[model samples]
Target: MNIKQADFVKSAVFERDYPEELEHFEFAFVGRSNVGKSSLINSITNRNKLAKTSKTPGRTQLINYFLVNKEFYFVDLPGYGFAKVPKEMKREWGQTMERYLASPRHKLVFVLLDIRRVPSGEDLDMLEWLDHYGTPFKIIFTKMDKLSNNEKFKALKAIKTKVDFHNDDVFFHSSLNNNGKDEILNYVEACLNGEVE
Candidate 1:
């Protein structure tokens, strides 16, 4: 899983206007605000500060694209959930993300969750919607270093019970230690490269 060359592609305010050509199998990361979406990406790609992590929430306003090894595009989408920003602004942001997730044109999605905390209501909502819409997605547990063995198992079990998705699609991950980074990246590359599943 060596990402020889990674580059930031573009940023978009709306999904409809986001690069019309789905030339590559794009991998999009979605989760609540400050759910380590940016940090997870940076850690997984082994690129420090590539995704722009911050202590503050709601900073990622648009959909950002990063090309990986010239094979697949890692799409860093705006995080949804509670934000420190204004209510009106958050509502607009939600709509923007929704359009992208529900898009029939797009292919794969990855739902990121913090390992220590239980799956929140919003997280469940997103998973349910993805299943209802039949979107191909997988779950990635982030920040595993903060959790104990028992806690990690509990989190995984709860997520499995709640998400109405294929069991094989569920994946465990930790971006901080780069555990499961290769598994995730390899899976995405396999899917995008049209290799047999």
Candidate 2:
């Protein structure tokens, strides 16, 4: 997909506050804190600062919506787990995510995982929740540039020991090198075109 225009539309915390443009399908980006959601968004959109990137985890607190090509939205869902925030705030974040996931406007969810780390309990729980709700999702292993070719193989194998996913079922991305950017963008295009579910 050739991105002609990508702009920050709004930040929202509740369904009532979601952009009135529900006609546009929303592809939600969700994952644990510090998993590189913002960086990946910036990379895919070819915008350096479209989504804020931070070294600190949980920097993205609200649901940020970015309009891409004026056709759909790239929804940056709040990162979950290991944000160094209060327990109540974390719980509230989880609740907020649950409410958003139930919306029909949420067409697809990209569940990002750090390739260097084993999938956390929270990560597994997110997958289970999506399965239970029948939400269409794609797994993305980030930070691929941090690993060697052999290490990449081993890491993906280790992840499969827990998730039971096939090689083609997930994507490996690197914001640093822009790896897997084309495949992801193409997938998004297919999704919007009704070629992929």
What lDDT would candidate 1 get against the real structure? 0.79
- For each candidate, what is the lDDT? 0.79, 0.91
TM-score to native of every candidate shown: 0.88, 0.97
For model 1, the run of ten residues with the poorest summed lDDT: 162-171
What TM-score would candidate 1 get against the native?
Answer: 0.88
On lDDT, the leading prediction is 2
RMSD of 1: 2.2
lDDT of 1 by residue, 1-197 (tens): 57777788788777556765557777889998888899878876778878999889888878888878876778888887777888888888888788888776656889988766677898988888888999877898788788889987776777667655454666667766778788887887788778833
The segments of candidate 2 whose C-alpha lies over 4 angstroms from its true place after superposition are 22-24
- Residue range 41-86, candidate 2, lDDT tens digits: 9999999999999999999988999999888899999999899999
Clashes of each: 0, 0
